[model samples]
Target chain A: MSDEDFQEPEVLLPLDAWHRAHGARMVPFAGYSMPIQYEGIIAEHLWTRESAGLFDVSHMGQLLVSGEGADAALEALLPGDIKGLREGRMRYSLLLSDEGGILDDLMVTRRADDFYLVVNGATKIDDIAHIHEHLPEELTLNHMDEQALLALQGPKAVDALARLVPGVEALSFMTAGAFAIAGVPAWISRSGYTGEDGFEISIPAEAAEQVATLLADQPEVKPIGLGARDSLRLEAGLPLYGHDLDPETTPISADLGFAISKRRREEGGFPGAQRILAERAAGSAFKRVGLIIEGRQPVREGAVVQPDGKITSGGFSPSLQKPIAMAYVPAVSAVPGSTIAIEQRGKIFTGTVTPMPFLPHRYHRQGSSK
Target chain B: MSLYFTKDHEWISVEGTSATVGITDYAQSQLGDVVFVEVPAAGTAVEKGKEAAVVESVKAASDVYAPVSGEVIEGNAALEADPALVNTAPEGEGWFFKLTLSNPSELDGLMDADAYKTFVDGL
Candidate 1:
């Protein structure tokens, strides 16, 4: 009903100086100064899909949750099978409210004595506070703000990263392990947001610039900005937390049923379990679906569509050489073949509802594609 | 023949009453790789400061406003197939449309290349 009143001061990332030296176009995003582009968004996007892209995502909230019942405690806050998560394995899960709304979507990894979490950057402050309120006091939640996160992604990401960290090629998709990169102790995960075969490396902040320089020196790797990172994730059919998944959006409404593990779905112990389970059975009012826009103009996010749909995420697909978008439409118009029109600035563009990952995912799983 | 610019970053080259319209190199660089371009059809009347064309990049779509009131002479058909031309040659073949100026006096409010360069630098 009113204008947003909260505006926080932006901070600089660990590699801010490094990015400036490399001719990155810096912009404000998620309360931090981030690189929107280096060479160019389209060029960087294509390079990442073709070869390798090095992304600085240190703004994300990395945390360590430790205690005897930390796993079950986290499971209570999310509708994910946290207890079933094996050590060195990662699970994409949602931080849900008790009233069935989404707070954030995060990646959780089971460690030897604690659970590791990587939460969305913008909501990390609130996410940590929310977790604290839900978890038991005995469990320690340590924010790893002093660390930096880098994602090396592409088809050649494995070969490029193996140049510094040997034997990491053995880790399969959705797996994590401790590895030494550039003589610095780091936690390397074979899971990435790009839906490409890549690794996410976490290093100490002091050593961030050196590691990034070493990785960027590789012929296969180039510094990609937030623009390319966003395009890459959109192509991967990944829902950004602030854009696609919001407070009013449930996992079922966002078409994130895969995040709700089978055990959790049946046991129904997590927050908002009753309402979510009901929606899972009798369809939510709106369903998230993919669209291949018929024109070159990207149906940008926040555009409303015909026959009752609201776009959550939309952009140009570099891989498909077309425009693509994700929107939530009424159940009746959620069919794959349905045609929708989006009117922007007095011009109308037609779009067709299609299956997502507008480009095929290149994730290397154990033995076969999932 | 004379060239003029607008605060919105559109550029117009005047040859008598008919003028060629396109965005400046500064604008093309700002918008990045343009994937789609939609110019008003021939015979369509556009008013100064009103939307005349649309340009879309991978990140977002932007409206291209008319620098002066005119009737569209023709839209660039080549742009319908290849919009990246706007990026490579924004001032030449990348022109969005040719307009028959209804009021040549409207051009006086626009900026010259030197003034536009100063304005862009200030921005």
Candidate 2:
């Protein structure tokens, strides 16, 4: 169905015209019209793994948190140590419900001046409401709906991005900085969901078309659609919000404890901190793990994991040349090398729990200062 | 030399005892970026209108059925590494398999290229 058919009000990207012109098959996603594929999903998936793929992810929400009590205000809602984040650095963190379950995961960047946040497009409204309701009166959150986001991902991404934005090459993985791309002001971050060295460029919605066209001209870059985006992220061991991470899954159980800072864990102020921290110390009942399907048959989402588990996300991984999936199973059955069976269409497909990132991540880490 | 198509979108070009099989161009276009093709084993007896192989795209998976009863004599193995061949030349180099026809009259029950085109157009 078209996005206009959605019950919730929908938002279209500034590059919607460009997307349609480039032969993208538009589909309704998270209350927006998005390109599900262009040439084809498998080709785009392989292109991103072997080279670079460009994605128009402008639908994601960007917010600016500022004011005198910003850090303390943020600390009240998130499990991250926002006060300790160094300026110009970015931290991946999560928003939690009062019951201690994860509401959404997001990236919080400490700008030279204010705290900039990038959250999932689908949960942005709820996230904003959650923050506004919980934050102290002294702090204010400004939703930057005027901006657009693009993810340039894969091996050739860094070099291509470096040419477009000169100073971006200096940033390490998970780092963020402001720069001008093709003379257009933009925010560039050295992070992506495709398990590759890439950049997430945030630019004014007005400049999005120019930037997208300029990048599409590069021989290494191809217009990737959401169909490939999902496959690439799955291969990278990244979780999709509604499928992999939900209200019922805590950060600890999702193996996202790394996002929770040490200071926050010790002080215990954030929502569900007690349950999360305790789960960390004692371990969780179930854990998310990657699966390498034995045969060519794919195990799709909602497929049952027997003798006790469930497939959270699944698809054919072009990079691995096999069907891969992520599943939540008993902690004992979630270990790497654990044999499991997934039921798909009345037949059972044998799979094994493998270490996440069926493919190795190629993040650009900075050299040690020691 | 008459062309025939199965409802599952597989097309076959029959030349007496042997037939060339492949997915229709419309089928490949619909699949978009074929990633894998599970080719049926050569010499296997496949029943007409039964599932014989699979074609997987990035977004979903689909089964390829035998357009007519036959003994598969040959199957394309190149698709294992480069499934894009189907997208590039679905009716030519992208042929899926070759079958030794067991029931030549079964071809009469299949759709002709013109009828197949109309069937897909209506879809």
Candidate 3:
């Protein structure tokens, strides 16, 4: 690559050089030069599972939906009942187009009288523009341009985080709260992409380095790159914006109908509500599912999904200790235990569709007995 | 026994009719994480400069070429489940296979350790 190869996007991380100095294999991701792996991806992936992994995710868009009428303004673009979301509570919702296809899935949280939104790194620009164009003028969309996002994830994440930012344990899953991390005012959310117990910390851009350094000093934390992040998310059965989803994929077909509230499905007010509601009631043509490959040979993106279905993302999964993949297969092939074939280097290999999170998800579900 | 390397970053240690093969440290570094290794089964014949095995990282896959023509008498099945062995000790436990050299003269075509070091430095 050349600088010409990438049309630079906004939101670069504060620790770009630090990542390179540590022998990080850098790649262009979400408009930033970020480490894809350090000390190799497999090691980082396994380390994250067995312990904790720290990820620099500042390139993602963080914005505050505030001012009068913000809640109603946002409700027009998404199907989720944002008005019902209480302060500090978070909900996973989709940004939909007129046809009910998904533009992106984002987290919407309620503040005292405002909404805080976090959107995917790759689609944040479009997400912002979509909000600006759709929402009423009384509402204001303020993008927090100078902020850094860090994710500390895995079984040991809470212990490591609690040591630095006290009272975080009380926040619970799908919750966000304002707190001071090492004297720096920040927002901490008990949410992440790794399907492990984790926290996503958003700190001021100037304070990012100090916070990252503080976390790096912990014995349980190591800087994980995009390479391990990909495998971890793949193993977790989470979707990557451009790969697992796009404007063409509706939430129903993507198996994300759960994000739409029951009231929203019945009332039918959001974009593409007709198509989405019909799909929800009638089922979709194809669905996204996980695959456990027969051998050690890991398939990759665009490796023709044989017999017609195609894989959007595929790689060696560190969590499962085997190769796994996510693909859009025909509805018949999307069921768990359905046999399929993926072609690599002109040869077809056998695989079976398996429920996602190749490893059981360890999210801190609320109201569970300890 | 002296170790020699090919330009493709494969290293071979030859003592006589037998040789051990693995990837060079530089190759492993470029590969990032070693997740899976697919080696030719034991008793398989491999031609020089041909794809005899594969090593995969989270990001991509690479073909490991045979530096010398030979019959693979032993493949490292341990790598199938524990590919990290290659990252941990590429020269020792990470060795991919043991080959019975079909043509001893092929050894002369490989670069010695010193030459290989120079080759890697330039890369």
Top candidate (DockQ): 1
Higher-lDDT candidate of 1 and 3: 1
TM accuracy, model 2:
0.85
What is candidate 2's lDDT per residue for A112-198, written digit by digit as tens?
A: 768999999999999999898887777888999999999999888877877777767888888889899888999999898888888
DockQ scores for all predicted structures: 0.45, 0.28, 0.35
Error of 1 at A163 (Å): 0.9
The TM-score of candidate 3 is 0.88
| lDDT of each residue in B6-117, candidate 2, tens digit only | 7778889999889989898888877777767878889989988787888877677788888899999988888776777988999988888899999898988889978988
What would the per-residue lDDT of candidate 1 be over residues B1-123, giving only the tens digit for each residue? 999999899999999999999999989887788888989999999999988888888887788998999899999999999999999999998999999999999999999999999998986
How well does candidate 3 score on lDDT at residue B103?
Answer: 97
- What is the lDDT, from 0 to 100, of the residue A364 in candidate 2? 84
Ranking of predictions according to DockQ = 1, 3, 2
Q: What's the DockQ of model 1?
A: 0.45
- Best lDDT among the predictions, by candidate number: 1
**Model 3 chain A: which ten-residue window has the lowest total lDDT?**
A1-10
Off by over 4 Å in 3: A1-12, A20-23, B1-4, B13-21, B41-50, B66-78, B97-112
Q: Which stretches of candidate 2 lie over 4 Å from their true place?
A: A1-10, A368-370, B4-22, B37-53, B63-89, B92-111, B118-123
Task: Report the candidate with higher DockQ, 2 versus 3.
Answer: 3
The better candidate by TM-score, 1 or 3, is 1
* A275-352: candidate 1 lDDT, tens digit per residue: 999999999999888899985778888888875778888888888898899999887778889988876555587888
Candidate numbers sorted by lDDT from highest down = 1, 2, 3
